[model samples]
Target: MKKIAIGFGVLTGFLAFTAVAFAQTYTPLAPLPIGEGGTTPDTYTLSSYLVGAIKLLVAAGGAIAVLMLIIRGTQYVAAGINPSAKSDAKERIMGALIGLTLVLTSYLILNSIDPRLVEFNLTLPPVGQSPAAAATPVAPTPSAPAPVLNNGGTNPSAQPVAPAAAAPVTITSPTTAVTPLQNIINARINRSNDYSVISNCMGNTTYDLCVKTDLNGDGQTNLSDIVLFTQKGNLFDVNQNRVIELANTTAAASCFFKMPGANVHAMLPRENWNQSWSDGGSSAWYISGYSCGGSGGITGMPTVACSGATWIKAPALMNKCAITNGYMNMPFGFVYGGGSQFSKFQNWVTSSSVGSAVDLRTLFKATFFRPIASGDGIPQDEYFETDDGKLTYATIAEYDLNNDGTADFNASGADMTAFSACQGGSASGACARADFNQDGTIDARDLNLVKLMRNDVFGGSGFTPLGWILNWFESAFFDPAGYSDTQIISYCIGHAAFERCGYADVNGDHKIDNADLTAFNTGAPLLDFNSDGKVDLR
Candidate 1:
């Protein structure tokens, strides 16, 4: 009966302790740290079970000690009359009190250290992850945008600020482009081994072995020498390799002064005909598979006789001015112009008696006007009969501007709309002048081509391909006789003041006005490309 009473009392004390613990407010425990001390699931589990067992043993021991104390006290009270019994009960009571004290003291120490130290917490790291790795939060990896490839299509690295508007500077082969002026500077300053001398000594000037080396005939020995060398002279094969590349600026700049005789130039190595010099710097003789200076088979340098006036073949004419100058000085007040001038010049040349005196057949000789008698499907030379029934010759060289030998100019069904656009100062002299692509028609591409080239000249990021420039050159000025390549560089440099540098200035009047407006009408709905609207002349 006494044991049962002790047990009931111990259970009541335990319930009271639990109630007190529940009533007290405490800070919510932080989440259990799983990775510390190299703790593994198996170890944590074993520890958890062992700690729980120890806590249970301690609690059971404390309860047992309390029960024993209660029994010992009851025995002491009941042993009032007997001295021996009372003494024994006192000793028992002392032993029970000591055991109870020890158990309570141990529990207090553990609770004081950390209540959680006695709790069962055995959380494992995520599956397939280490505890330390799982403890840290991982961030998502970022991806990069794709690169813009170099196909002359898009320039991803182009500067936001546009490069200054300048004359066309590149000399292109089939697959590469080199700036002549820049190349010359690099060759001379760097003394690169890629170049070799092509000319012999006539007289010593600034250059070591050559005479009359003042390329521009400018007394000072300066960078202009490199530029004028290409302007005034043509490149030829010095090694007789039949494969001619660019001439060295150092040699050519000096040798170009004593032309025909001092035919020296700097030679850049080229492996094949495709890389050879095909731009205006090449001589007509060399281009025709003959000798430079008309030696080999062509005698006395075949010259075209325009009336009594004799002009050198197409290759000799440096620019549009030199090309057109042979026929007549541009009417005294005449200015720089574009493809629209084809009809204007034709009209002036045919109507004017001075122009009438010159033979029209000799002046215009492009294959477009006069296809090759053999393979060029159209055998008869294209001509324009004037209002007075006078036959005026017209033709443009079959220009494969993009190096695609297949001619882009289709003659059979040419764009009459494009032809009509060129009509202003004269009757329909040649309608195809507005056909910028020579696909035998004028469309949005042609209009956009003009806008791009025009914007390019005005310091915009409208990178018109060099091929497009060459194509436009054939359409303009209408004298199929002269070369437009090298001349175009000089023309743009000299005519920049007049705004005639871009292909957009249609009438060569130094402005983009009415003449240029024709293409915009036919090619597209009127667009304010730069969005300046009516005020934006460009």
Candidate 2:
């Protein structure tokens, strides 16, 4: 009975121990906040769990070591008289201590090597809910070509070329608002007035001598056309009288020095060549009988023929006079009344006195006055008459009276005087010379034209005849001409007269103000002050 009770008690105690051990619920640490997208914990989460587990394991090992020491002490006390029992208890205690030491040492060593080693997590998010599996991957951006750094480094692949700089702005202004001074000057200077004398004498016997000085082609010898011979000189018809408009009747009635008919008998001795004869026939004539020693009869004083007698007409007389005097005859009728009577002309004939004349063809290789084509907005009459029956009645103005290529405006006293003289005259009188616009009268319009042309000429607006010619030459023979606002501004600032003369009158309304400045800024070539190929206020 005692043995049964003891066994039953032991069994009961074992059962109770087993029940207690099994009943103590192992509460697994509440899973850390679920990873993003409910996936398994990340390395950090797992590492944290491992650290907790190691701490728990160390506590458990320490508790087991303490329980073992207590049990070993009890066993040693119960076996106080037995050396083997004490020795066995001590051994068991030592084994428990060694096992605990080993477990702790292993944990320490593993933690020292890598704390994450103990962070073992068996928990995982449900299938199909992994954060990494649901994440959207990102694409990398394309890289630009690296700049070529000239340091001592390996060369890189070629890069794309850079774009070019922006082009200059092309500014434009209103043409209608601006006075067309360039066109006006071009028209005036390049008149096609066919002076028949130039055409007739071109191939004549006198051509060799005639072309030397007979430039303006009026069948006369004068200073204006002398440049035709020199080719490098300037010719300015300041008086505006080189070309004249004549009535047909007046042209026909005009008389010049002439030789008498071959049928006429000589009234005076041929030897008395210097003698004078006055004829009452409303005309002037030279003594025809004198052979004063030249190919043509000697030039003599005017003679009055006896009644029904023969008198030399003027045209033939001029030819004879030219031959005798060793000069070319003025194509205009001979001057009868003043100290000009029998004034010997020097530049007319091919006399040894003057140099040999150049051929007209060679001298005029380029026509200075190319007629603007018709329908170009300019009046047909703007050009001088051509031999093809095109009669242009426009008169060139004496705007630049000083003949300095630039219109001097108030600086030119001569221009002022002439303007005053013809300021109020009709088209038939002296005012005709100042009739710049050719409206058949010298009025405000004519003065205005002069003023416009003067401004253009001095302001370097390229409206003067010479300016137009040069521009035309450049465009025709070289590269096309280009003008800029800089050039116009440079001219305006360089010339003081331009400033005073209202150079800013870009729009011909005749006011100098902000509008002009705006026009200039917007690329008015006329505003360029010094022509330095740039546009700036300075």
Candidate 3:
């Protein structure tokens, strides 16, 4: 009965130990990939476990040695001078010590072979015996937001343990964009290794290597020179590989001046094209191949403006200051103008007349104009006719002033209707109406009318020719075959002004009317653009 009881106890203990071993989970933690302090945690854990086990064994051995020494002394005290018996006793002591030493040496050898084995640590129970202190749980930290893998969508370390049970997951970080301009600038500046000299440019002044110098040589820093400097007067390559410095004269963060005409626009790095504009001006440099216009369309045509009146009595009125001469930041693109000239505005697109290979379709995709406050919601970006009260009219037929396939500037049936609003409000300071009476006369009446026109304070439209000045000749002018607005205005105002005699009345038709109007209108035989009706360019 005693033997059976002992056997049952041993069986129970063995079963309990087996159950505990089976219940404990051992999850395999993989090593981190290409990271800092990877193996340190694992090594520290293993070292501590080994040190503890070794100390436990040393304590047990010390206890056993003390017990043996006590038993040996008792046996010796009981022995009656038996030398052989003493030798046996000493041998047992030595044998027990040798066994302990062998166990320690064996343990050390095993640890050296597999240091990781030492990490099998047995945690001691907490001192307080409190539930919280006894098992201070270590909550696993949530892994970092998975990084985007760079290896073509494959992660280097995270391999599936069960190939059939789990699918491979890939994570990657977003790619940063590239700047090609800096590359080009570097290459261009390296003249010793690449091309010869920068064409038309003299030398660098902190910003560019080649540039034209104004007489003052102050760099005459303007948009035109900036373009010429960067393109080297070539107009073909505008991608900036080099940095244009930020100086007092020109301090823009970026001034990428690629000619958006043909191949240049396409070959350039950035994908989208940009533009901008203001009241009487736009900065959307002309782009070719935009879907907005197909072949045979006026895709590259100049900007058409509203000349408020037809000064049939005097045809020199033009919009001089209304156009912007400086640049403005527009949500859509850019608007540059504030300094050029009166009546001298034109779009800054690539001169398609020069024929280009650059694909600027993205830029020409659209064009926009900001709304004018006075227009009640009417966008101020279309063909503007002179207010009829001002005698102005549109020179170009309305097609796509908005450049979005819509007729934003229709002058078709709008002939004189647009001029009614400004019949007498000729903003033009140019002398156009003084040739009212058919004779040459600057009488008090004509001076009074001109003075009123100048101040724009108040006026009436009913001056039938009696109260105005006459031109030295007859009639007004028109545009030439190939001349642009700037060309025409420059030629006329220079040598075309008659002496200040408001009423010369050279052709005395007596009434300051048609006869006087004829004098202002008379051309020198074959007269042209000027209302003076003269053909003298020399």
lDDT of each residue in 1-538, candidate 3, tens digit only: 3433464476458435533342222323763221112232322332243345455665675577668767876776666688888777776666656655654665576554333233333333435454333333222223533334777553322332334355544333112111232233334443331122222122223224333232224654333443343333121111122211111121111111111112211111221233456677844433333332222312221222211211110122222111111111111111244332111111211211011111112112211112246432322222222211111111111111222222111123121223223244442232222222211221222223223222221123332222111121111111122332222222222112332212223243332233332333331111121223212121
Q: Rate the local accuracy (lDDT) of all candidates.
A: 0.33, 0.34, 0.28
How large an RMSD does model 2 have? 43.6
Write model 2 residue lDDT over 300-360, tens digit each, in one string: 2213432121222212211221111222222222233432211111111111111222122
The per-prediction CA RMSD against the true structure, in angstroms, equals 38.8, 43.6, 39.5
> In angstroms, how far off is 358's CA in candidate 3?
99
lDDT ranking from best candidate downward: 2, 1, 3
lDDT of 1 by residue, 207-266 (tens): 332223344455543345434333222221112222222211211000000011111111
Off by over 4 Å in 1: 1-60, 80-84, 126-130, 140-538
**Which whole-number lDDT from 0 to 100 does residue 379 have in model 2?**
26
Runs of candidate 3 exceeding 4 Å displacement:
1-55, 70-80, 121-538
What's the TM for model 3? 0.16
